[model samples]
Target: MSDNKSNLTEYLTPLIPLAPVLSVKSLSFVTSKTKKQQSILGCSNKLQLTSGRAAIAIALEHAGIAKNDEVLVPAYHCESMISPVHWRNATPVFYKININTSINVDNIILNITPKTKAIIVTHYFGFLQELTSIRAVCNEHNIILIEDCAHAFFGSLNNQVVGSIGDYAIASSMKFFPCYDGGILASSTRPLGNVNLKKPTLIFQIKAFFNIIERAIYYKRFGIAGKGINALLKVKEWLWNNIKSVSGEHYTCNSPASSDGGYGLEEDWIHKSTSVASNLIIKQSNTKLIIEKRVENYQKIHEALSGLTTAHPLFTKIENGFVPLVFPLYVDAPEQSFDVLKKQGIPIWRFGEYLDKQITEAFCPNSTALSAHVFQFPCHQELTNQELNWMIITIKKTIK
Candidate 1:
């Protein structure tokens, strides 16, 4: 049992712990300071929700889309992105994404029908989609445009931020910032009138605060004493499991129920505002510094992986003013490579792999290939140079 436990400890690194939570002092400072200037898209009258999916649900409700109305979504997407449409009893039209993860404009136009009420354009992996062309198509067809910037919190294209491009845009603030939970629903033309979201319960807020603290400690100590920390976490997990066996509580400390993705917007939480902790952290964070560090990390990985025989980066260059969420690499044997990384406890993500079968069939061959091949590596602000170097080296070795 001890040997098995030791072996398990080798594969227990926390996934993507870059965004550090703010301290109470920092939160107080942030709240006391003057509000930051708004982007080209005004910042007033924004509605915050429990998660990005909730934001989408509100946007759909605001657009007045009803049952039998269709909303076009990319085939290369997570379940959370499409689930809201289904929850509304509306049909979802899945469009194909090209090799670069951008929507095939032609395919999207082809998929549009008279019943289509709205089109969701996602800026996948923080790379901007060709919004100009898509926007024109939406106008011509009289369809509402909802830009999904969940992966792109603060990036710009042609001097305009992504959220400004669509009629209504939704972003997952928790993805980019060190927040326990947050989602923003903003509009370009009009104010998002009272969403009626309530404040998160005090218990929920307390759990979030402690989760953030645990994440911070894990990240701060990983570089110095990763093995020791991981061992302790394993012991805790074991003790918790034994307790659960005796009490039949089934409680897990690793991932809480609140952290799970929502299939539909709950009436209780859909109107709930972003947690105070999340709002304060976002207000306190240095946007410029976060963008620069992420860009820098992405470039470093790109330089290292370029021209490799076994794998190559999807988007070869980072455009000006773009802040990437991850460094996407297309490996020849993604399954094998992924397994190798998993054993070593390296954090990697593969979107679109677990998509619905109907979506996979409707989309093009490119979507299928991308789903099987692409792996998203960490390029966030918290990673040390040494960690980045180690990741690059491990990826090269794994792919080869």
Candidate 2:
């Protein structure tokens, strides 16, 4: 192993001795006031499952968006977000991103026609977008505002949650929370009232159950799993391609998000605060130790890379609660840096690399720039100090 890898292994190996092994019994929790309190705070009554598209579907319906309506979306989002607009028979008007990597839409709004009904603003990478300005513009035009809180679960801007600012907000519980799957569509100003859920297909429920089992097994064997999932996904893709039609619409804030209760839950597709996820959310919510460690590691990595010519942090540190998803480094030449890091056995990712570059030409200049320039290092809760140091050293050595 390289010195950095060896150092990381040695550092983590000792922690394994001190750490308690995960047991099925320990995973179980006793009923308590704290647990009950968590359920109340976490939108326990409001969350539901869609085939993973509940958020957008709810937003589209609440906004009264109709066929051929246009909804503006950030050019820098996952392709899944656009599926709702297409499913609704509406068009997506792409908007550019600013240098700060926040949504920029001055040009997009100028081009907005009578068909434009709403805009979906994403708080990318947990950084709260400048929604105050966007809300102001939307109000003037009598356009609805939808906040994509998929990446901003606990994130807030100026003491207001991202989901609270807009006319409607949607979030996926699986992204930030420890839950396997679920999404929430919430409103503050308007009443969502009660939504009736359609029964999910039996095949989807079976597949979701097996997929969870497979993911658990892979995690146990490989430390960080999902390789088996990719193989399974390929087979699924092939089958889907041969098939002519699939029941139910794709999940989105604009459409009624579809749900097949994930894995075990068949009766309800929405996330009911399970004893398992409730505890995990509580544990992670007040994660002072994890957050501090990550912040420290981020500082070290930033300090070390600040001197490098091609590597630099993406945002200012002074922003309110600007916790990083990972320590991001923007390289002038990404493919070269990626190869150099890979050769050294460091795992890295070109975050959101799958975004449609061609469609981006409509708006999103900064999103396009970031797509080619930035790479993420793993800074999830499991990271250790040794791993952080090794990562810093690896970056210092790899970057010219």
| Candidate 2 residue spans exceeding 4 A from truth | 1-45, 50-52, 198-297, 339-347, 357-364
Maximum-TM-score candidate: 1
Total backbone collisions for each predicted model: 4, 17
Candidate 2 lDDT, tens digit per residue, 1-400?
A: 0102122432222211111112232224434432332111244234454422556765686577879899988776665577777766788877777756677667657757889998888776556776788888888899998887765555455766557777877765544333344566766676655655554354444444444445444334234444665567678767765563454445322112222111111224342322233234434343343344445655667677777777777764625554444566788888777666765666564545556655464455687777768876655444456656777777787777
Candidate 2 lDDT for residue 393:
79
Candidate 1: 10-residue stretch with minimal lDDT: 1-10
TM-score of each: 0.83, 0.67
